[model samples]
Target: MKLETEIKKPSHQSEPDYVTGKKDEIKSYGFECTDCGADINIDFQRQIKYNWTGNTDLISESERTELKKYYGIGLSEKSHDGGYPVFDKIVCKTCGEEYLTYCGVREFSNSAYSIHVQEIQKIK
Candidate 1:
């Protein structure tokens, strides 16, 4: 019988990982029903750290890039207190129930806090 062993090396040098908000803030959001005409709102103060506003606005290049990294969640942008940018929002198609339901914010995550990233760590 024969046994073989292989050594693995790191791909990159050691670097401190950052996993926090670039800048913490709240982005508001509003929802509107397509069928009816009802309106609603949701506050993403803690989740994504953004306020809720019912309007559409252009996102910044850096913000867009950050959002692209995340699958579901974005950054916080605000034009004004009442006219701030919304992170996430959703509306019912079948019913006319418009409600604010979305928090669009993405931040770098640490392996320690992330379940998906810590899967291997759970092993004995």
Candidate 2:
């Protein structure tokens, strides 16, 4: 897969605020395909794992630190328990564009999941 440049946010937004906003709050959060501009919902459970091997090379040092602090867990640390610190490769249902998304799951009754997508890049 060929790696493309990082996705840029709109001029009005400072950071990728959509990355942390709830799906209900942000209508286009994590749904738009960067390549095709298709609105495709991401099914985390059904999507194939990216088999990241816990490599932090794809992400910047500041992003790695921010992710760890926000998630309250180390990105490279392995959990004895299952289901956390998800790093998966997801395909765009419309254009077949692949993306490597890093996410942190909150183990509440509802199990909130947030994707850190400031640097989400397309993979060919």
Worst 10 residues of 1 by lDDT: 114-123
Tens digits of per-residue lDDT for model 1, 32-120: 43446455334334323332222223334454344334322234342212122232223345563323221222233431110011000
lDDT of 1 at 5: 18
Candidate 2 has what TM-score? Answer: 0.42
In candidate 2, how many Å is residue 11 off? 18
lDDT of 2 by residue, 10-124 (tens): 1222332222245554523355787789875544432213223332345555554554464355544532222244444567777788775554322333433333233355656
- Reference-based TM-score of each model: 0.23, 0.42
What is the lDDT of every predicted structure here?
0.28, 0.44
Off by over 4 Å in 2: 8-29, 44-83, 108-119
Tell me the deviation in Å of residue 63 in model 1. 26
Q: Which numbered prediction scores highest in TM-score against the true structure?
A: 2
Name the lDDT value of residue 104 in candidate 2: 33
Point out the worst 10-residue segment of candidate 2 by lDDT. Answer: 9-18
Model 1 / residue 22 / CA error / Å: 12
Which regions in candidate 1 have their CA more than 4 angstroms from the true location? Answer: 1-27, 49-103, 108-124
